[model samples]
Structure formats: C-alpha cells, structure tokens
Target: MAPEYLLWAAVLYVGAAVGSFLNVVIHRVPLGESVVKPRSRCPACRTTIAWYDNIPVLSWLALRGKCRGCGTGISGRYPFIEFITALIALVLFARLGLSIAFGVQFAFSCALIVVAYIDLDHQIIPDKISLPGIVLGLLAAIPGGMPAMTDAVLGVLLGGGLLLTVAWVYERSTGREGMGGGDVKLLAMIGAFLGWQGVLLTLLLGSLLGSAIGLVLMASQGADRKLAIPFGPFLSLGALVTLFWGHAIVRWYISYAGLAEI
Candidate 1:
C-alpha cells in the first residue's frame, strides 16, 4: 500500500517480463542459435506466440498452460521462471533500494536464473553468458561501483582459478571430471560482481550445501552416485546467499573462532 512497496511491485513485474526474454536466450544460445533473429514461438508447432500469450506469468495462467493453436502442453517452467525472477527482483530491491547496486544485482540475478536452468537441463554452461558477464562486471567496478576494480579482478581470478585447479586435480586422481568448465565460468562471473570475498563465500557455502544434498540423494533408493548433478544451481544459491548475508556470515565465523577483536 505504501509508495515504496508499490515501486518494488513494479520492479518485480518488470523483472518477470525480462525473465520471459531470458528464457529465449537460455534456450537458443547453447544451440548456436541467434536469440534475436526469430521471435518467440511454440516449439511444438512453431506458431508465433501472440502478444496476449507472451505476457509473462499472467498469460500462462490465462491460457491454462497450453498453446492456443496446437493445444500443445506448455512447460510450467515458463511461469515458474517468471515468478522466480519477480521474487528475486523484489528481494534485491528491498535490500539495495533504487540504486546502481540494485541494477547490477538484478542483472546478475537474471544471469544466474538462466544459467541455473540451462545447466540443469543440458549439463552445459554457455560461454556466451559467462564470458561477457565477466567483462561487464569488471567494467561496472569503476571507482563508484559496488566494489573496487582491484577487488573485481581478484574475485575473477580467485573464483575461476580455485575451481579450475581443483577440477584438474580431481580429474587426474579419479580419472573422471569432477567439475565442468561451465561451473568455473559461472563462479568467475559471480566474482566479477561480488569480488574475491564473495567468491570464497560462495565456494564455501555452495560446497557445504551441495555436499549435504548429495548425501541425501545418495541415501535415496532411486539415486545413483554416478548420476551427474549440475553445480550451477548450488553456485547460484551460494552467490545469492552471499549477496545478502556475506558480511554477517563472515563476522559470525570470525567471532565464533575467537579471531576478531571484541
């Protein structure tokens, strides 16, 4: 009801719209297709979606999640992505207010959303997203940016290098690739925005959370240890958690370890 809440709601709505566009990029970029050349169409029938059907979450609900012409079943992922993007935008707005930091965080969040789903479905992270993201993030780290340029560069190196080294060692020892290039790039992209401390935080948090989930999955009857689980989602989760709670988490750890002056 308040003006601030209304502004946040509007931001979320815009974010949802952006998510719809991102869906196109996520689906096309990995396949070596131009995301801009063709407008959105139904995969089932190649019918160009009408403007009415393309209105983010509302259209999906209105159409009952089916193509109007071919009556094809639409994946719920469409609305789900929109909804998640909206939620993330609202949260970021609340945390950062209306500022450049909010814009940077919003862009980073959208990238993560796309990367998370693409990696989950295809087991690949497109360099198209990560490589450009690194450059953009560093450019954003001008004198007035969220982090200094020095921090941005260090973050990129630390995030990518640490993962790359571990991946190499794991592969050499086990004769299996324990990490993918995509994962390395994703971390590097995240580091560009959050800096080196964020990279370390993301790694520690992601590993702990991922290991727990893996343990739970292994205990389940239908799960196999050999089954590959995409790391992008966990990395995204870690980056998000770090974005909101990194300072507090670091302070808590230091105090718990008696390493901080009280």
Candidate 2:
C-alpha cells in the first residue's frame, strides 16, 4: 500500500477512537458523571462492553445497533459520530498535511462536535468544554501559528462582548432573555481560535442559519411563539464553515464587492 494511503488510514482510526471517547463525554458530562474509570457498557443492561464489542463503528455494525446483553436498540448516533470524526480527520489532514496546524485544528473540530451534540440533547453548552476551550484556544496561537495573540484577544473580547451587549439590550427592551449565557462563552471560544474575522463570520452565518431553521420549525408547528431552540449547533456549524472556508469566502467577497484595492 502507498505510504500516503497508510497515513490516511492511521488518521481515520485515531479519529474514530477519539470519537468513541467523545461518546463517553457526551453522555457523562451533562450528568456530572466521571468519564474515566467506568468502562463502556450497555445502557439498557449496564453490562460492561468487551473490547471486541466496543471497536468504534465496527462494533456498532457487528451488533447491528443492538445491545448484546439486553438486545435493546442502541443509538445510531455512536457510529454517526465516529464516521463524522473520521471524515473530519481525513479532510483536515488533506487540507493541512501532517503538521501542527492539522493537530490543533483537528482537536478544535472535535471539541466543537462534542459541544454541538451536547447542546442539542441538553440545551446547554457545558462550561467544562467551552470555558477551558477559550483558554486553550488562546494558547493554540503560540504553537499552532495562527492569528497573532493580539488578534486572538481582540476576537475573544469582540465575540463575548458583542453577544453580551445584545443579550442585555434585548432583555431591557423586551423583559425577556433573548440569548443564553452558554452561547456567549461558546463564541468567545471560537473567536480565540479563529480571530476577529472568524468571529464575525460565525456570528453572521450562525444567525442566518439559526433564524431560518427556527422559522421553519415554528411554521411547521403553526406556533407563533418562539421555540426553545438551542443555537449552539448552528454556531458550531458556522464555526466549522469559518474554519475551513473563511479566507476563501472573504477573498471572494472582497473581489466581488470591488474592495480588492482597499
């Protein structure tokens, strides 16, 4: 086999293994349970899963998405998360090669995946993830060779401060909480990694996507009231888009909008 192909395969396997661990985090973090010490188990029967039966996507396929102990249905989410993680690893590898950039961005992407899924299930963005994430994101600048540290700090301030001010103004005007504190922290974390440009793009795109989806859901249900929608997933999606294509999108806009000179 080609060496390049072998390297790609290795990345996929590692990514999948990490994905499996992320599954544990997703289940345990929201519940305040320890992720370590407890081996993988069948949720239905609480039977400890053997190593052979816990091999990422393969295990799910082998068991046909059923718990071997109780024959209860297992969530398809496991394999899906694994697959997505593997794909992300491969794509990041392709885009950045086997470099520090790949490693840091890969980790950031994984955290975003965990954050997105958890927020979807619990309507929360965990402080455990986002809080440390902001700090680590700033640190990533030194080793990851990303935006300048000053830009990163500005990004954090802009991201967090912008949303906070909005939420405050919104509450004062309507006497209702318009946004969650979790989202502010989440944006701050994103800004730490991607810098101010990324912060702006994520906010704009995330808002558009969230608004469209929220409207559609409410329309489908014929509800005039605001739905209890978690905005984290849309924000995650926006961050991912910015991570991959922000520069390209910005360049395109600059050229198309006749701002190439300035």
Q: For residues 146-235, could you state the per-residue lDDT of candidate 2 as single tens digits?
A: 977888888899999999999999999999997899999999999998998899999999999999998899989988676788989999
lDDT of 1 by residue, 196-254 (tens): 99999999999898889888888884668886888998998899889878999999999
- CA lDDT scores, all candidates in order: 0.89, 0.91
Clashes of each: 0, 0
Best by TM-score: 2
Identify the candidate with maximal lDDT. Answer: 2
10 residues in a row with least lDDT, candidate 1 = 1-10
The RMSD (Cα, Å) of candidate 2 is 1.8
- Cα deviation at 235, candidate 2, in Å, is 0.9
